[model samples]
Target: MPMLKYLIIILNDASVSFCHYESAKTGKKEAGMISYDNLNKAVAFALKNNLKVNFLYPRFRPGKKYEKLIEDVEHVKIVPRKLGGVYSDAITVLEAGDLRKENKVTGTENIILRLSSPELKILPAAVKEIARKGGRINLVIKDVENFGDSKISEYRKLLAEISGLLIKKSGENSIPEVNFLTDRLMLESMNNCDAGITHLTVAPDGRLYLCPAFYYESGENSIGEIRNEINIKNRQLLELKYSPVCRICDAYQCRRCVFLNWKLTGELNTPSRQQCRMSHAEREASGNMLEELKKKNFKGAKGIEIKKLGYDDPFEIAVKNRYSIQEFKNFNS
Candidate 1:
């Protein structure tokens, strides 16, 4: 297995979600805090493995005792916007409703903006706000599982408008780092989540999970206990080469969330239509933005190219261009 580079420690069952899945609504009984003993073991495990830790915080503080344990290591904090005043340096998550209030955002803070399909209409304005007051904005569509043909079309149109705004911002020398658009411009290869591949999660139960989403789904999904050797069944399925569509895809910035894959398609390596179409929409919008930037002679846009694709969904391409067994073996070799 590949060496783990990062470990996500979910501080509590009620931890605020900074990603697609909601931690508070997992329907699981409150498992309370990760015991101080397990917490120490987790930290020791991380230190021994030379892994970077990311502490996910809940709405309320974890108290001074937990705070002290967290401060012992150099780590990143992912917290909800409600606690932004407390952990000011943390990567803060703001839901669609949060944007309605008068929230103060410093231009140096990394923000994760979570939105559903209906809330996507506010994205353009949100982008403008972030460009004016934040560092980077990671847009996480909360209901990606519900994205259909019509919603995907609407998302594409919104992305086009967002691309135009980003182009304008670039010309003004104040380009905001919107992950959906800006990330695709610079990524040359697959920059996916790679949950079980590059990083793993340690839930409050002191067990290892592929990622936080898996742990939230079920403790039964844990690969192993944090104190034991990590073992992930069918682990190769998490790699890029094992993915039929993703291996040949160029949506380099797509999260390729494996949890969503298993939930929607019943396979770890296969992606749902919603995921593929949405990623390609971002890729297409990025390509258009890159062209506009090049046309405007934006110096920073030099050397980046997002090529055009014939289809929005990679499954369509994969179906039409199926590889033979020998071809697959050669490709992997």
Candidate 2:
């Protein structure tokens, strides 16, 4: 049985689906909200499967009925920062294009900032402001595939600058965690967002998918419908142990988005070069930050070790050493 923990429900077909790949919301608007009957069934399916639901909202407000149905169960709601209230307590997700330094994001406790590669370079000022506001930040790169090895220094510099700003703003208070850099410090093994393995998504069409991206990208992307049994063929592809390179890699904070794997290499188990290198760079930066934090008397990072690696992409090293599938298991053993 799949150890399913979360069910991401895209409330409408038009909901903002931001990540490392292209936007799931295709051009010109269309009526995309799922029928009330379908949504109720979806919620029932979640309860049956013992999975927590997470609703992804679009620009418009859901009707009273939809709202009540969503509130009936314990679930998470992800809405655009521009959507204002209704789901004010929900996790606010912002696209880089939508944020300005002057714009005030009302409730700032847990915020997700989405940025493309180019926007990432110019957003230190905005990030500093967010850091000053005192909340947890998840800096998600929508176009991580564009991140090149040459830009590793820039990425590190940005992380260092953000760390400095966050430390300065907090003064003696506990430093709020930064997802990309600091997450690795606290993790001992691969702690990726196990998309298809540990989580599943329900689309507006009432079909279950590996994730929301799969639903919006193509209806055929769905694994099964709500009324039918939840089916994920060859489910092992979603597990980390099934991945040759990632299984041995120590970059515990890498998202390891399976959708990106399918998008970049047309294989669910393989990862792209950009994904590996960027994750390694973050890993290296986190290691440095861990050492720096230990010096500042942050004992939580004590005894953490992230060895210096010559290759940013583990696949290169594995290939160079002629590592086979059995060799990966032996290395970890």
* CA lDDT of each prediction against the hidden true structure: 0.83, 0.75
Model 1: residues with Cα > 4 Å off, grouped in runs: 25-31, 103-108, 171-174, 324-333
lDDT per residue as tens, model 2, 1-333: 247787888888777664554444542333578778888988887787777988888877787889899987779888876564566578877776667543543465677778877778655666565666667778788876777766666887887777666555533325666788767877877777788777888887877889877776788988887754556798877887677678768999998989888988898888998889889888888777666676676766546688888888999866666657666566431
Best-performing candidate as measured by lDDT: 1
What are the TM-scores, per candidate, against the unseen true structure?
A: 0.93, 0.90
Worst 10 residues of 1 by lDDT: 24-33
Residue 107's lDDT within candidate 2 is: 61
- Candidate 1, 66: how far from true, in Å? 1.4
1-333 in candidate 1: lDDT tens per residue? Answer: 356798899888887787878786442323567877777888888888888899988777887888898888878988887787776568888887787776434323578888899988888887887777646889899999888888988988999999888887775334678999999877777888889978889888888899999988888898988865777889989987789989889899899999999999999999999999999999999898888888787666556778888888999988899867876677640
Candidate 2 Cα misplacement greater than 4 A, ranges: 21-30, 101-106, 167-173, 322-333
C-alpha lDDT of candidate 2 relative to the true structure: 0.75
For all candidates, the clash counts are: 0, 0
